[model samples]
Target: MADRFHEGLRSQVAFVTHTRDYRSAEVLPSLARHGFTTTERPHDRETERLLAQFDPDLVVLAIDPRHDDDIALVRQVARACKAQIIVVAPGPHPHGLALALEAGADVCVRDTDGGEMFNAQLGAILRRKTSPIEQEAEDDGPSTITVRDLVLDFDRCQAVRNGESIPLTPTEFKILAYLAKNAGKVVSPVEILRAVQDYTYSEREAQEIVKVYIRRIRRKVELDPAEPSYIVNVRGFGYMLERRSNRRDAVRASEAA
Candidate 1:
């Protein structure tokens, strides 16, 4: 495919993968047409140095989720650069995509996606970086929200409980934040999924996917994962993050029991 040169883009891209030959020919040329300068590195110790030198506007990591260290690599890259990231997982592991996003990638795309689709993802990232609306939203909102003893810092993608930091993946944090933002209301799994992932799914599928992440969040935030007080499941409905008043009532009920 011919590279389409979009003027004024000039974004520098850094691509990192386990091997030098995994779709570089396709990815580099596709990005080039978008007026992005490209650099490639193998996923190794040297990659961080290359990233430091390249100073890219975006970083693309090609990874398989099965490798235990892949998530670590994502964290390493995230710590190494402030660049927006795109993760290309080469197969049908939706869970892997979740983990990649949780680790800090701005977006995750499948290897099977066509060049145009890939470029579109890049364009979206660029737009988000420069969009006036996004800037305005960032400027206008309170960057943190407090829920019970937990404090969520939106600017940092971090959560704290009782003066200690609670470790949460980006997706997990997003789910928790969404729930906190709508505390006391029952939220359907589809609503949680759309709020966190910005994608729609069948209700059943959304339930299963959201269930797993909610369970994971509970383990991190709840005093008892088995009997979650903050994230309460509404039978036949969905889940709710208990409001402070509800939490006190639950506490009183527990004390009486």
Candidate 2:
């Protein structure tokens, strides 16, 4: 779609369309002007070949509802490449939208909209594509911790809950951050003490001090301090931040609903 304000910058994008109608003509030129090298593919084989060769940053599938095979073609493209996909469907149908999402279309647009809206949607999708890899790298990197809504910003020395700032004392923050970063894995009181404090102490003393600080930190963060959600006592082993259980429960609830 044409965005008059758009300044062309080189970004590779692939378009899969079954027809060469006026609408397609209008859309392709705008994409080219925006610094995209557009290639039109009519079949799945051609689409896959183009994707493998050009290695596009995004794939836009303009589906023709008349062709039932178009849906299958979309699924093929999704499986064959890792590019972020945007599907343009003819109308608003909940089933079709769900199918598109299931087929790995990151975003879907109904053809009822004009070019401006389409351009804006395209821009937003591209932005998401660029950011997610960086986010995933950060998630996979060491020294980062995530538990439910809480995220310990190690570099910033702060804890955040659903984007809201949560204040914590230096000692409390370090202790929680360490536990969360090593989530789902138990760390003994001695190990925690060594990590958070430099002073040498007996294992018994370390266990006692770590327990007290953990309890205090839990009271400040946990929704139900008595029935902890993020951090859990591992009894024989020590303490671990439970993340998988919460995620599993959420998935189960969604499936049930």
Q: Which candidate is the best by lDDT?
A: 1
Query: Model 1 RMSD to the real structure?
Result: 6.6
Q: Rate the local accuracy (lDDT) of all candidates.
A: 0.70, 0.63
Pairs that clash in candidate 1: none
Instruction: Name model 2 segments beyond 4 Å from true.
Output: 1-11, 19-22, 64-68, 129-145, 148-257
lDDT for model 1 comes to: 0.70
Minimum summed lDDT over a 10-residue window in model 1 is located at: 248-257
Q: Candidate 1 residues 161-212, lDDT tens each? A: 8998987755677789898888778789889877665556567656656766
Q: Pick the candidate with the highest TM-score.
A: 1
The residue pairs that clash in candidate 2, if any, are none
Candidate 2, lDDT over the whole model:
0.63
Clashes of each: 0, 0
